[model samples]
Target: MAQQATPVRTARLGRALGPEPTAVSGAVLLLPAGEEISARRPSPLLATASVRALGRRLSRTGREDGLVAHVVHYRYRGWNGPEAHLAADADWAVEEVVRRYGDVTVCLVGVGMGGRAALRTAGHEAVNSVVALAPWLPEEDVAASPEPVKQLAGRRVLLVHGTNDERSDPELSFRLAARAKKANRDVCRFEVHTDGHGLRQYRDEVIALTEDFVMGAVFGRALSRPVQDALAAPPPLGLRMPLAAGFGRSLRH
Candidate 1:
C-alpha cells in the first residue's frame, strides 16, 4: 500500500467565492493582520473585522467585475522567523493565481504584518499594485543574503497608516515610501489622522480606498485616475515635501 499523505495543519489558503457568478478581471491576494512575534494568534483573514469588511466588498465587486480573490492563513504568527514563511506562502499564492489565470494583473492587499509580506511579494511579475494598510515596516540592513523587499523599483505601491497608531510607527511606512520614491519608484503614502493601528475610526473610508485602489486603480479601467491621484498626492501633514526630510515631525506628528 502507498504511504498515507500527511494532513494539513495550522494553515489554510484558498480562492474566495463571490455572491454569484460574474465576469472576471484580475486577482487580489489578501493577507490579513498578523504579528512578528512568536505568539500564536488566530488568523486575521478569518477573525479580523477590517478584513471581513474588505472581504464583503471584494466578494460583491469581484462578482460584478468578474475578478478573483484569495485570503491567506499562515502556518505561524510571527514573520521574523528563519524561513520568512509568509513570503513563501505569498509566492505560492501568486504563482497559483497566474497558473490558473494566465499572465494577468494582480493586486496585493495586506494589513499590518501581512502587508509587509505583500510588499515583499509585489515585485513579482503578476503583481501590478499593492495596498498595505497600517503595515509593519522592515528594519534597516538585512542579514539575509538577498533582501526580500528590495525589488520594488517599477511597481505601484500604496501605504496607508494611522497617526495615532501605537502598535506600529506610521513614520516607518512613510520612510519606506520616501526611500522607494528616491529609488525612482512610484509610491504613495497616506496618513490618516488621529486613528490607531486598527483604524476603527474610519473603517468605511479604509475599505472604500482599498476597493477603489484594487479594483479600479489596479485594473486601470474605472476609478483609476482619481484614486491614483488621491493616493499619489502628498500627505496632509506636509512631511512628504522636500524640506521635511529627516525632520522632527516624525517625533510628534
Candidate 2:
C-alpha cells in the first residue's frame, strides 16, 4: 500500500497595498476565516474574498497615517484542534512584518476563525493591538482548550460581534471580552445589532470603527467616546457596548 502524503504548507503574506515598507510607520495584518478541521490547503475562501475588500479600504484610508496592510494566506484551512495551525501562521506573519519593516507597530485584523487566530497571536512583540470581527470563540471545554486571554496583556483588543450571528456565538465572544478586559483594561467588545456574522448591513460603519480602533492603537490617534468608554467601563457595560450607526461620519468630523 502507498503511504499517505502530507499536504504542502504555503502560509505566506499576500501582496500588500499601502505605503512603501521604508516609509511605513504602522501596519495591519488581515487574517481571513477558515474551517475547524482539515489538512488540505485552503483555496479561495468566501471569508478571504470579503476581507480583501476590507483590506483595500483599510490600506487606502490608512495611507495618511503611513500604514501598510497585508492579508495573510494560511497554509491550511482548518484550525486542527490543539495544533492551531492558523495561529502559528499568523505569528509567522507578524515576524515577517517585523523583519521587513523594522520596529513599526502592527495591528492584527481577523474575521471569524481568523479573529480567534489574531487573539491568540497578540503576544507577539510587534503586535500593538487587535481587531476581531465576529470572532468564532469556541465554548469552554477541556478538549477544545479554551483560548487564553493572558497573552493580551498590554495590547489593546477590540472585539466586534453581530447579535444575530449564528455561525459564531456572540455570547462566547462577550465572555472572552470580559475575561480579556479583566486581564487587560484596554480590551473592549462591541455589539452590532440586527446584523449577522457577515456584518454586511453596516459594513461601512464596521470598517470605520475598525479603522478608528486600529489607527488609535497603532498610531495613538484620538479614539471615539464609545471606544474610550468601553475600554474604561467595568464589566457588562464595557463588554456589551453598542456599535452605533453614523460612527464613520463621526470619525470624519
Candidate 3:
C-alpha cells in the first residue's frame, strides 16, 4: 500500500520588505531593473548608492508619514510572458498592504524591467499612483500588459526617461504618456535629456521628481517650496531593519 502526500503549489513569485512595522496608512513598492536574463534578488541596480540611498530616504519619509515602503525582490526576471508573474507579484504586494491597513492607498516605483512591471500592476485596486524610471519597454513579441491607462483611469502616473538612454527607447515612454493622457489620466512625462538608462547624471533630479509625485499622488502632498529649496540639506542618518516577506509559499522570507 502507498501513502498519498500533500499537494504542493509551484508558482514563482517575489520578496517584499517593509519599513512600516505595523498597519500603515499608505505604501509604496519599489521594484528594481532586471529581465529574464537575470532575476537576481536586489538587482545590481539596487546595490548602487543612487538606488539604495533613494530607497532608504523614501523609507524614512514613509515612516515619518505613517506610510509603508516595501521593496520587491522578484523570483523571476521576466514579466508574465503568458502568466503575468511580475504583475501578479506587484498586485499581491498591494493587496497585502491593504489587507493589513484596511482601505489603505498604494503607490509603485520601478526601474528597468521593474518599470514595465509597475505599469502592468498599476491596475490593482489599491494602487493610486505609479512612477516609472527609465523603464525598458518590451518588444512586439512580448505580451507586455495592456495599456495601463485603461486599467488606471483615475490613478496618477509619472514616466521619467532619459533622452540619451542607450539601453531603451525613451520615445516609447513618451508614446505611452500620450496614450495615458488621451485616456484622461493624471499623467506627467518628464525627460532627462542628458542622462542615460542609469540616469547617472541626474539621480538627484529623478529622486526629487519621483518623491514629489508619489507624495502628491498617494498622500496628497508634494514638497513645499521651502522644503524643495532645501532638499540639498542632508538630514541625520538612521538605520532600521526591513520587514521582509516573499510571494506565495515563502512570504516571510
Best by lDDT: 2
Task: Tell me how far the alpha carbon of residue 122 in candidate 3 is from the true structure, in angstroms, after superposition.
Answer: 1.0
Cα lDDT of candidate 2 equals 0.89
Residue pairs clashing in model 1 are 23-66, 24-66
lDDT of 1 by residue, 124-169 (tens): 8888888889988656556644334456767777788888989888
The alpha-carbon deviation from the true structure for residue 124 of candidate 3, after best TM-score superposition, in angstroms, is 1.1
The full ranking of all candidates by lDDT, starting with the best, is: 2, 1, 3
Instruction: Spell out the clash pairs found in candidate 3.
Output: 80-84, 246-251
TM-score for candidate 1, please give it: 0.78
Query: Measured by TM-score, how close is model 2 to the native structure?
Result: 0.93
lDDT of each: 0.68, 0.89, 0.63
lDDT of predicted model 3:
0.63
Q: What range of 10 consecutive residues in model 3 has the weakest lDDT sum?
A: 235-244
Q: lDDT by residue for model 3 over 165-201, one digit each (tens)?
A: 9887887776666666666436666667677899867
Off by over 4 Å in 2: 1-7, 18-22, 45-47, 142-145
Off by over 4 Å in 1: 1-11, 15-17, 20-23, 39-49, 139-149, 222-226, 230-253
Measured over all alpha carbons after superposition, the RMSD of each candidate to the real structure, in angstroms, is 7.0, 2.3, 11.0
